[model samples]
Target: MRVRMTGLAGVIAIAALLVGAAPASAAPGDASAYGARLDVTLLGNPAVHAEPFAAANANGPTQNTFVGVDLPGILKTGVINASASRDDKSGGVYSRASTADVRVDLLSKVTGKISAELVEAECAATQKGLVGKSKLAGVNLGKLGQVNADPAPNTVLNVELAGIKIAEVIFNEQYKNNDGSLTVNAIHVKLLQGKLGSLGTGDVILSSATCGPAGLPIPMASGAGLWIGLGLLGVVAAPVAFVALRRRAALNAA
Candidate 1:
């Protein structure tokens, strides 16, 4: 009886290992629409896209931040704002978005400027992307409004981020599993809007991505080679599974 019990224990242990070792989904699956909760920073040039908007413009620093909160990727909400300086070398232009709540899809991607069309789709999609609540700050005019310029000698311009241009994005792709843990994947963005700006008005490319959720780091991937790199992660996780099973069984017996 003792020998039989030992054999049965081994079988159970192996079974547990297999179950625990079941592979991560091939894609995000139903949860693909969401991503791990994280704060994000986007940086790019704004002057390049300011062609028809401003003749000879230069963009200082283009940045946008996505605030993280406690929720699933699809139902998640966040405060997002961006700022940039566009100057025709004579006048100054600045941009701002008053703090507002927007529905977010952490795993999704935005290509060109965040146009009315894009905003509508995300907010309207079944797994909505961005659900903007209300306008935060009143739109600040850069050239039309006579505002104080920064250290630079130019017209003060403030444009609300009603539409934004994006060349690339580095965002977390989160997948919430039945186990409750999130599987994160970083995507190094690549797109066509690199040469565009907000409302096709700014002179730079706008980029956005997620930053946190404590741990679980996944690298950004842009091409075929990215897959090859990700494949190795599964191999690395195998041994860790065995150790986890042993610890669980020991605790149960005790």
Candidate 2:
């Protein structure tokens, strides 16, 4: 009985190893499957896409014990886990639904200009691939009005840095959520290239990717390769089976 039980346990272990050997559909507690994905390509004299993400979520540091919550401090709030990404082949922009409640507070005091200049400076120095004249511009998404916290104050703001233009981009959304997590979705950002005079006039690309969940690190493709290898084994085995079957038939005919 003991020996039989040991053999059964060995079989189960082997099966578990096989299933776990590749990136299977994420199990429960694992992030839900990556939802929909979007991609875009454009052409013209000014070739580029400024696609915006639909809806999404992001994070940050401990709220100040007493300062009135404002945009600059909120900007400092870091996203612990972001479902943000960008890719030429896979997607242009993406957003996760805000999980917490939201009530955006529009503040007239905050000017997007400071953030715009700051971003442009950073890009000119580090983003070699992004060459251009760019600056921030606001799209009149009129009547966004004052944002407020829902249920009274927790909401999530998901922002992906990947999809932003290198030269300059402006954020005008003023927000607050019931749970303290506020989310901002697709916003119009201007693009530019070459010289300062030429900024916000032509070609640029924008994009984002859905990050899985908070706390978990972004998943690498190593597991994807493992699954691909398993699939290739299936293809190779099919040919070997065909050859073996042909041999058996030939002998029987003989």
Candidate 3:
């Protein structure tokens, strides 16, 4: 009986060591975001092409801000802000972007003006938290049509010049990247026509965000807990075995 109890204790101790040596859980996903990205041309001349402020894979909170920019009669902006952050607690990521005071004069025919406010975009691990918000104050799109404040993903607003389609305004643009990441753009302007009567063609983006895939769930008893429990069992068995051996020795002596 004592030998059997000793063997059981050994087995329990070995199992505890194995459980403690198991590999750890996978790490959380990465995150990336930008305030504004512009790739445009005026009569084949590069106007504004750059991503002014951006962040990626930061362990903590990160942010950036820009005063204003201009393309002289083509496009103009005021006060751009962007931010990105990660939550180690929930293994989730988040990002946001916003712009203010925007004006776009395309060939002086199809003009757009937004007063003191522009757009914002947010991204997170969950679908409910991923959204695009438009704060287009005093918006006036001359001959282009109305702007949707809360536009769905890939919502397109056609641009026409003299009853002919010339360009398009895409809102809440979202893409599921090949690597399972999600990208959200608050606003995207694409000039389809090569030249809208000498204006030229290009693309413009505002308030962009992206986040990597969700992390796998972690299980309980996958770490030290399992080892500790088995260790306690081994301790109890050792004392029980010692007691059994002492009693057997006394009986043999008698």
| All candidates: CA RMSD (Å) | 20.8, 17.6, 7.6
Q: Which candidate has the top score in lDDT?
A: 3
The predicted structure with the larger TM-score, 1 or 2, is 2
lDDT of 3 by residue, 195-248 (tens): 444356677777787775654333224455455555766775677667668767
For model 1, what is the error of residue 155's alpha carbon versus the real structure, in angstroms, after optimal superposition?
18
Compose the digit string of candidate 1's lDDT tens values, residues 1-254. 44345556655665554444333211121111121223232343222211111111113234444553333322233343433333322122223322233333322333212211011000010121211111212222222232221111111222323354333332222333454323322222233333444222112211111111121122223243346444544554555556556666776798
The 10-residue segment of model 2 with minimum total lDDT is 117-126
By summed lDDT, which 10 consecutive residues of candidate 3 come out lowest?
Answer: 126-135
What C-alpha lDDT does candidate 1 achieve relative to the native structure? 0.28
Predictions ranked by TM-score, top down? Answer: 3, 2, 1
- Writing each residue's lDDT as its tens digit, candidate 2 over 175-253 gives 3334322233222233333333332343211111222222212222245555665565566555555655666677679
Model 2, backbone clash pairs (residues 3+ apart or across chains), number? 39
Q: Identify the superior model by lDDT, candidate 1 or candidate 2.
A: 1
- lDDT values, one for every candidate: 0.28, 0.26, 0.65
lDDT of 1 at 80: 37
